[model samples]
Target: MLPPSVVKDRVGRTLDRMTSQNIDALILFSREDIRYLAAFDQACICLVIPKEGNPTALGLWLDIDEARRQSWVQDTRGFVPQYHLRIGGGEAQRRRLVEVLIEKGLSRGRIGIERGLLTLEMFDTLKSGLPEAVFVDATPVLKGLRIVKSKEEVELIRRASEIADCAMEAVSQITDVGRKESDLAAEAEYVIRRSGGEVLSKTLVGSGKRTLCAHPFPTEKTLEREDLVYIDIHPSYKGYHSDLCRTFLLGRDATKEKAHETLVAAQRATFEATAPGIDPEQIYKAGISSIESSIYGRNFLELYGHGTGLNVEEPPMITKGCREKIDENMTISFFQGALTMPGSYGLRIEDTGVVTKKGVKLFTRYPTDLLR
Candidate 1:
């Protein structure tokens, strides 16, 4: 959990943005956004942040007490019947939210909402309840505010990276010929969970032909000699996410080793080229140029990296034509590699890091060597 001062600063910054947009109030529904501002870990129905007063978090009756205990928000409420015992939990919560908005004098005022995340039911309720209010999308505003990491956020991400590194090391030790791809995934997951971390996304273990497939999950297929296997681990500590991937060659093969070397070179080039004020597109170009010089250049993947923190993939995605500036304090998951052949084999390497005045400070410190 972040300090109360950090949460206050975040809410203050959000309120500033809201005032600039002339929004009378802001409604947050997504768990990510809600947790960002409130530190409420459980699923919630609504979190209303007015322009002048404290924010209100509305959740299910069962989780309301936990919400109060966990979040910095003081005005947490649970579902209660408006008049009789007829309304359901969802409707009751929406009704209470509308009342709160009305009480705060925002019933017919300009409101900001996460249009991309809100469900159709919540949208309809808000529109009908506050017929004269204008709903502006707050997706960009919210995303923009979280692009740069605070010192606390960076530390959580760093710890998560260490967890990923441990998982990768465990996977490397057990990866051998005849082992099931699922076994590697199991070991990685066990290490992460035992380390007080969570696997919130796919535990990818792609081997042989499966390496060509994007975001492939582990299966029961057994590993064989001279096959390429890639393990992508996603782990989170205290709501912060980190991604790390390493490719392994089951048996020594010169062609596969060279392919892995090209990936490492590309990753290194991308890292060396990264700095504050750099264009994300330039980073992509540098990585692609490194790959183009290799034998497997034709099979290069388009993406070079992405911003990572609360989520696995975030803004300022490093790709061709991306215009977002690479700023200091931004956490990035620098990744590059490509398929050696269409249906034969592929290799990839990834690590998490933070952008500093000097360059990207890598968080995941596991070696990128192709484990045998």
Candidate 2:
């Protein structure tokens, strides 16, 4: 749970955005947005935040108590499904949400919504329910506000990165020949949970031939003496996420060692280029130039990195043609992965941190040297 002041600050910023856009109220259905504003995480929940006033959260009866305890909002209403009525479950929920908006005096005003998160059926329902209200897509507005992190949010991400470092250390200690990839992944997860962290995504563990595929799930494949192992971990602390990736060589090979060196150098260039007021394109170009300068010049991915926060992947994507500039207090993950050839092997290095005035403050501090 976040501090009440932090929650209030986020809500204030969101409300200001709403006011700027002339939105009488903003209805958040996406779990990430709701959690960011109200700190309420539950299914069948919706948060209605007006331009100027306290927000209201509508949740199921079973979860309303917990929502009240966790959420900063004082007005939490539990929805009682009217099963005996002719209305269906979806209709009932939609009607309840519409009623809330009407009571807030937004029935005939412009209301902001996450169009990307809503299904066509639900969107139609919303439109039909409030015929006089103008619903506009506010995804960009919400994402724009969330791109920057507060001090408390950055602290949580740092703690999450620390847990990721610990988990990687556990992996280093257990990675060896004859060990199953599943076993190593299990060990890492245990370390994260015991260290007061939660796994945000599937722990990526690939070895040998599996390393060729990006985003491969852990399998029963056993480690070999001469194999390339890749691990990507996403750990969260207090709803803030951090991403870390590292590739290790089971046995020494000059070619793989040189690739590792090149990868580290590219990541270093990215870190050096990251700072406030710098175009993200420049940071990406710096990384690409450094990678192409090495012997594994032809091995590069299209995407270098992305912004990180409540969601594992967020806005300000670090890719070609993206014009998003890095700003102060924004947290980003700088990563680069390459495969020398198809079905051969791969190497990657990723680090997460907060952007400072001059540079980035790295959080994941695990050694990038290829583990023997």
User: What lDDT score goes with residue 206 in model 1?
Assistant: 89
Give the runs in model 2 whose Cα sits over 4 Å from its true position.
1-4, 80-89
Best of the candidates, lDDT: 1
Candidate 1, 83-158: lDDT as tens digits: 2111133665566777889888886888988877767777788789999889999864686788999998999999
List pairs with backbone clashes in candidate 1: none
Candidate 1 has its poorest 10 consecutive residues by lDDT at 80-89
User: Candidate 2: which pairs clash?
Assistant: none
How close to the true structure is residue 202 of candidate 2, measured as C-alpha lDDT?
Answer: 81
At residue 182, what lDDT does model 2 achieve? 97
Q: Candidate 2 residues 112-204, lDDT tens each?
A: 888777677667877888899999988756967789887888999999999999999999888999999998899989999999998867898
